[model samples]
Target: MSIAIVDARGWQNTLDLKTGEKIDAAGPVIKLVKDVLQRHPYPGDTDPGSNRWVSDTAFDLIDRYAPRFVFLTYAAQYFSGRYTPMSKETRARMISDVFLEAERFINRSGFAAIAVGTGDMTPLLGFIDVTRLDGLAVCTHWSTRYAGLYGPSPDDMKILEEHPHIEKIVSQEEVVRLFDGTPEQTLRLPEYLMLAREGYAFKTISDAMRIPVMIPSLNFNVPLHAPGHTVEAITGIRQILEEDLSEKNVALIAIEGVGLDEFLWPHRPCRNSTEWYYYEPGEAQYLTIVSGRHRFLDYPTGSGYKYFNGAEGAARSYPFSGHFKSIPEGAFASTFPGKSIAVGNKSMFMHMVTGADLSVECFARNLYNQGTMAVIHRADKL
Candidate 1:
């Protein structure tokens, strides 16, 4: 079976089987993606067929071709709707209605929808019925928490407070409850979003709105934003990735490589697929993930420092390891880099981390057979 990409505008594009995860979205996934949009219908345009991507052709292709994978862009995400003239309530309901309709249609058509986006989707939690949904919608918030970095679009705090069933969602019992995660630099949002795109499943920001969210992993490109260009943002993003040791660097993005896989490139029929990468000129070659079989690179890329040196290029991603190590606090404190007394076959070293970001850990660690195992460092020490 073949695959296809659906843009946020609700248009379709033939999925390039060769590119793997960088799936191109053209045909209408966005309801207005290709509308050139005349609302009242110009002349005979009254017929739905007047529009191409969202017209009969797209749905017909969906029915006939019946692709094995349907990739939906986050054309409907928080940033996507900011420009719309709709009020917060109208916008929420409008986007909610669009997604619910898409969910029902995709379900009825018998295909899993890997809904993709770039920000805190938790706001929509109050407005969406996730139980009836299948597949996943991958995006990033601050660390595994649903705390939105920017404006927290549509502000679920206000929405849920007004919701009659808000109790089921909020942590506080007060009717004036409002949900807020952590607020840091807005510059980091793009990099974190890119991390979401990288499928790192890093630490997700949390809040009362924090729910176990994300869809599937499949290599696809949503062509959004990249924040590594600036020295501060790039340096900050890299700090969290390589080491979020200090509180100062912690807020940039979650360094925990927990749900890295399941958030982006899906792990299925692609089960046979190994080594996930997104490489380009002068940018860091994100090794992202190497799944399934027990495999390791013979030689290290040694490009660790490049990511922060302003190479403005891709760093050979190696600090990322599919292995998780937990160090017992007291004894493990002495077990610093390259001098640990852990049990292992060959004498070797790896970048180790604790499972501080629970939400991201839960989302990423179990993505595939390679799986994520936690080291009980703190608990063991305690």
Candidate 2:
């Protein structure tokens, strides 16, 4: 039927009143619930505040509405007191206890299903007994910071291993695939079969072949800095859509971060090479070039002269197919623009393209190592 999406922050007595006064400790919790519900209408004569008086109200709403699903959205750090002036451990336990109580209530009430909407609430996902919930979902943008917030970490894997209720953990690839289009197909027939099927006229025949349709390459420049280090490497990637590669598309991805231990902190100069690379749509071609601390790499098959690194130099480009044998640690990769690129111990090759064409073959060839052998095309015209 219908669903109730509860924001725990709204229920807390932390809002500024119309009179510019804070809700007092003696303020009734029901009043807070009523205030929130008043903003969101209720059906029939049902009182939104009444159901919230006790934690059971969460379940009561689900049961009464008989909604196809009930969603709970929360900020884990805020709920666990990381953002507030409270004991972190104590607040985490308190929030966990409240949710556990809510789960117990939901179990007693026969509702369709309960889903938790983690809006950048990754840390709390592990803290909760997700196994008891019917379903769970995470949503966030594709920036490095947001990706780190929502992406599964070691802690998440541990929780998945221990919890059975976590039916699925959606990935960025899957989400992107949900928005891609299907492939086109054609059939071939023998001359006799064609004649038997229909009145055939003589026509020129072409070889059975799959010609690669090259999409225009987009350039992404990212800056990297590390203090007191002799050499630092920065890398950046962005997902590109096939439709966005048209000649009319003028958008370009640019770098915005200076090298530093913490990306949000100030920048300092260090000896480093900043590189940009991306995959060609519908083809296996990895194009990469190094700019800083060295001359720009040469295009695969172009003739251009450029100088950098305090000397007359030339650029040399290479196909990244199988070239990225390893990805260094501290290197950051993202499908969205405006993310810093850092290189550490692990060898990595990351790319982000425009549009919604997120084929598994392209993703695995560019990011993860587990995939079929990818054919790398060297740019003959540069």
Candidate 3:
């Protein structure tokens, strides 16, 4: 099996020295290709922007070098903000356009496998047809970040249990057992068991196990709390990804009871004040009230879905002070590629999942006052 890796550079940030400012750029993206080509040079000329040219180069490289695998990595900058500019739909469409261009190269080249480094490259996973690719992997230090959240607390194990989304929790010993197990036995365990059966679940067995289960399609009602109360919820999501769903390709969706403005305001105040004036919108603005809520929702699924909820687990929050919003009536099948869905609260959103093909919709209530939700879908379906 021959492999080829492609990496691009220069997409994440655009330099504007004239004003000493940086803006987002469209072309000449930066990625891992340079690093790989440095070690293993490709024959013939290289082309930029032409997906067909890139695809051909990948195949040519594989044919010439005959490597077991090839890795491709790239970066892109995404704009996030409140009102100063574009609407959410417009941003999403822009992203989708870039992704389609990249997919042409990825899907056409027949390689044994592809591995991607963490960065702005994750969203592309949702755009590609994984089934056509031999094997795929993403590299990130997500587990380490998750561990840090515990902050020298021994009760981390207990915290995992109360979390509705986390299905299993285990120690290092278990990891070894699963890795050493036979292929058949490992397959019977969690999806990660394909790598090792002894592996433990992070927050809940649902997070750990891929076994399909029956869950109601209707949405469930839950209460919202202060932002400080969100630690457990966020941590629970982290544990699920690091522990249970680490090896799977998944997407997340978060719904909020409060509008984008109130949910992300500093200090979790009901009303925006001058003290929280730092919440202004900008290209690099990292402090949007909505972004925070979105991060809490996407934290588990490795940022596959940013900002609003996708077709997968639609996590929504109902403010204790706000009324519940009705999801579009009628069941619509989730576009997620997997068999399970995880939710933050139950309500009309939950009902939507139940009515769809989703087998399970795990609900975690009061995890955060802001309504946020996530769903883990299979990659093949994408």
lDDT of 1 by residue, 199-297 (tens): 223232111223333322332222111122221211122222333222111111111111222133221211211223211100011111111111111
Please report how far candidate 2 places residue 119 from its true position, in Å.
9.0
Error of 1 at 296 (Å): 18
lDDT string, candidate 3, 92-116, tens digits:
5544443453455345543221111
Worst 10 residues of 2 by lDDT: 188-197
The parts of candidate 1 lying over 4 Å away from their true place are: 1-64, 83-86, 112-382
TM-score of each: 0.23, 0.21, 0.22
Scored by lDDT, the top model is 3
Candidate 3 stretches with Cα past 4 Å from truth are 1-88, 91-95, 103-140, 143-160, 163-167, 181-382
Best by TM-score: 1
Judged by lDDT against the true structure, how good is candidate 1? 0.22
Higher-TM-score candidate among 1 and 3?
Answer: 1
lDDT of the structure predicted as candidate 3? 0.23
**lDDT order of candidates, top first:** 3, 1, 2
lDDT of each: 0.22, 0.22, 0.23
